[model samples]
Target: MLHLKDGLSFKPGLSDLGALASHYTVVFLLLTHTCGGQSDPQPMVAMAGDDVILPCHLETAADASDMTVAWTRPDLSPKFVHVRRDRMDFLINQNPLYQGRTSVFNSKLKRGDLSVKLYRVKLSDGGTYSCFIPDLDKESTVQLVVGQWILRSLDLFNAAF
Candidate 1:
C-alpha cells in the first residue's frame, strides 16, 4: 500500500475495484514550522474564467535577483508553467494554453515577492501551484480552484459517462 500523508493508502494489489474504492479517504493534518525552507505558502481564490493572483511572498530578507524562479503546476509534475530570470520578463516556454494570460506582480517582486497573476482561468488550471526559487531556499505553493470551469468539465464528464 502506498501510504500518503492524508491517510490515503493506495493498494497496488486488489481483489476487486469496489473493495479498493472503499479504502480511499482524505485526512487533514496541520503542519507548522518555525523556519528556513525553500518554499512559502501563498494561496489564491478566484471565480472561474476570472483572473486571480497567486502570491509568493518571501518572508525573510533574501536577495533573490540572482536566483532562477519558476512557477509550475505540481499536478503536472516537472513541468514549468512560466519562468522568470533576473532581468527577463515572464516567459511562457511551455503550456500554450497559458500563454498571454500570466504575469508576475511587479510591486511584489520588487519587495522580494514572486507572486503570479493568471488570467482567463480555466478548470484545467485548478490545482496546486508552486513557485520555486533556487538558492534562496525557497519554494511556495498556492491552491487554485476554477469553479465554473470545473462545473463545465463535470458536465462534459457526465455527458460522456
Candidate 2:
C-alpha cells in the first residue's frame, strides 16, 4: 500500500498482474491531469564575467516559507551551490568556490520562486543545475551555457577589418 500527499492511495496485489498494470495507468493519468501541464525548462546563455538568473518555481503558486530548497551541480566539487531552510539561507556546507557569488530572491520566496542569481559566470559554471524541494518531492533543472566575451568581440572586430 502506498499513500500520497494528494490523498491518492493504491495497493498492489501480488497475485494480479493485470490489476496492477491498470492501477498504474490510472495513477499516471491522474498525476498528469492533476499537475496541469508540463513546462519545459528555460534555457539560459550567459557571457563570462556576467551575472545570470537560474529560474525555478512551483507549478502551483503556493507559499514556500517552510520548504527546503537546494541548488546543486552534480559535477562540481562541494556540490551544493546554495541551500535554504525555514526561510533562511544556509552556507555551512556551501561550496567555497561560489562564496559571495550566489543568492536567491528572498522577497519572492513566499510566491514559490526559488530562482538563484549567480555572479561572474565562469566557463566552469556551464553545466546542469538542479533545484530541489525535498518536502514537496519536486525538482527541476536548468541548463547554463557560458561563452567568452573577448573571443566574440575579437571575432566581430576582425570581421569588420
Candidate 3:
C-alpha cells in the first residue's frame, strides 16, 4: 500500500510496478535538468586604482537575457554589488561603496557572459566576490588581490636607473 501527498492510496500489484518505475524515472530527469550548471571560482590579481573583470559563465552555450544575475560580497555591507533583472541593471539596492564603480557587459549578456567590471580598485576591494544566477541556481566565486601600484612603480624605476 502506498499513500501519496495528493491523498491517493493504492495497493501495489504486478501491473502497478511499471507505473512505479515510470514515476521514478520522471523524478530523476527533473533533478538532472535543474542541476545542470557548474560553478568555478577563479583568482584575479589587480593593481590599485586599476579596472578588472570578474569572470563567470555557463558550461554550455545558452542565452542569459532573461536570467537574473547578481554579484555580492557577503562580508561587506549592502551585500549586493551589482544585480541585473528583467534585462536591465538594477542598482537601487547596491552598496553605496560600490555605486558608480561597477557595471556588467550588457551586449554580452545574451552570450552568457555574466562577468562584471569593477573600476578603480581599492585596497578594500580585495576579497572574494560571488557571481550568482538565480534562474539556474548556479553561482561562482572570484578572489581579487589588490596590490599597491606605487610600490611596484618604484621598483621598476630603481631597476631602470
Best by TM-score: 2
Best by lDDT: 3
User: Who is ahead in lDDT, 1 or 3?
Assistant: 3
Q: For residue 30, what is the lDDT in candidate 2?
A: 8
Candidate 3 clashing pairs, residues 3+ apart or interchain: none
Candidate numbers, best lDDT first, in rank order: 3, 2, 1
Model 2 regions more than 4 Å off: 1-39, 151-161
Cα deviation of 160, candidate 1, in Å: 33
RMSD, model 1, all Cα superposed?
13.1
For candidate 2, write residues 6-112 as lDDT tens digits. Answer: 57665646754464443332211000111112463334445777888877788888888778999998898889999999778998889888888999988788888
Report the lDDT tens digits of candidate 3 across residue range 1-161.
76654576667787677655444322110000111244333334456777888777776758888889999999988899999999899999999889999999888887888888989977788777888888988887776766662333333322332
Write down the TM-score of every candidate: 0.59, 0.68, 0.68
Model 1: CA > 4 A from native = 1-44, 61-63, 90-92, 149-161
Better of 1 and 2 by TM-score: 2
Q: What would the per-residue lDDT of candidate 1 be over residues 1-161, giving only the tens digit for each residue?
A: 54545576665555544443444332222222212243453333456667777666677755455556788876674467778886566564656767788887655566676767788777677777778887565777666656642223333322332
Backbone clash pairs for candidate 1 read: 38-137, 38-138, 38-139, 39-139
RMSD per model, one decimal = 13.1, 21.2, 24.5
